[model samples]
Target: MKFKRYASSFLLQIALAFFILSCGNSAEKKAAEESNTETTSVETKQKTILFFGNSLTAGYGIDQDDSFAGLTQARIDSLGMDYKVINGGLSGETTAGGLSRLDWFLEDEPSIFVLELGGNDGLRGIQLSETKSNLLAIIDKVRAKYPNTKIILAGMQIPPNMGQEYTEEFKAIYPDVAKEKNVTLIPFLLEGVAGMPELNLPDGIHPTEAGHKIVLETIWPYIQAKL
Candidate 1:
């Protein structure tokens, strides 16, 4: 009888240990699952701010981080805003090129879409009508894919190297598109930064680091209000 009792006691201890280990594993698994869920939720909460433009938006002469779009991202992060900025700018990109490749970026719906093309078209002396048509088509595509995406057209202007007639017409393209589409229009993207030698690189086409900072300020008001 004593032997039987000792053996039974030993078996009971073994069962107890197994039970404790099973509970510990279950608890750890539950905690890990909860953590993963929380992380996914945070990621989904962030809305996207798409900056679709050309070399000016690409930060041609300076570190991309110094671009206006980059600054906007930094500001959003610092404020803990639930928004992310996607820089879709391509160097030497014209409105036609932008429209062709827009579908790629539209895969993910953006909360705000800042259109900043046409400067290249103006510089190249592309017909103003063609430039305007391309801009409209691009906006239409965005609207079709994501109707709720807030569109903000960044107005652009080129030097009289294209002639005063072309220059003025180019400048009017943005507002015209914005008005027709009934979207937000940034009066002048490079308002304070343009024509300032210190703000631009030797090319005078792209803004320098300081210039991008100024550009950031110009658009912050519009972005802040949307956010």
Candidate 2:
């Protein structure tokens, strides 16, 4: 019933998967791999970068290695920086869900936490007020748990299914939350890749490997600044 609601919005034969059941994402695997090979005091001292969001952050239809989060790890490793990137992107996640699952990721202190939800909320016509509340709550949770953790909010946009007024306001959610909370904001997570058919998979929802590469660039500037 839930999928049926959003699937109707897309005029395509392929169902628009707002929530593709993701078994797991590459970010988790990469984080585990790094943990396994790492043993040095310096590695132990490395700061953590947690990319917390949905399928985009998880690399979705593409190989996890091709996801933007994976590219970020590669870049960090190449630079010999002491930061580990963990992709906490889950498919079919919303702001409320992200908030609920946030505590599990908080067991360890992360130097940075990137929030990348709400697109799913927008797709489902969730109330803007509720979405905003959840965003603030998630940020607050991290701050309360780890005062020193820097936060970055990734802005998201859904197709104009709910009307232009709603779409415009929804797009503003990211900056609004960022300003109210004083966290860094990535203006649009899918800046160059969102609607481009070549950049997305056949589902027309998830990004292709090339798209993730582009996404990596969109997010790198913000991610790089904190490093």
Query: Candidate 1: where are CA atoms >4 Å away?
Result: 1-43
Estimate candidate 2's alpha-carbon lDDT, on a 0 to 1 scale. Answer: 0.89
RMSD in Å for all candidates: 3.8, 25.0
True-vs-predicted CA distance for residue 111, candidate 2, Å? 0.6
Stretches > 4 Å off in candidate 2:
1-44
Worst 10 residues of 1 by lDDT: 162-171
Tell me the tens digit of each residue's lDDT in model 1 across 1-227. 99999999999999999999999999999999999999999787879999999999999978888999999999999998878889999999999999999999998899999999998898889988999999999999999989999989999878899678878878888888889999999999999888888889998778999999999999999999888
Give residue 76's error in model 2 in angstroms: 0.7
Writing each residue's lDDT as its tens digit, candidate 2 over 103-161 gives 99999899989999998999999999999999999999999999999999999988999
Q: How many clashes show up in model 1?
A: 0
* Residue clash pairs of candidate 2: none
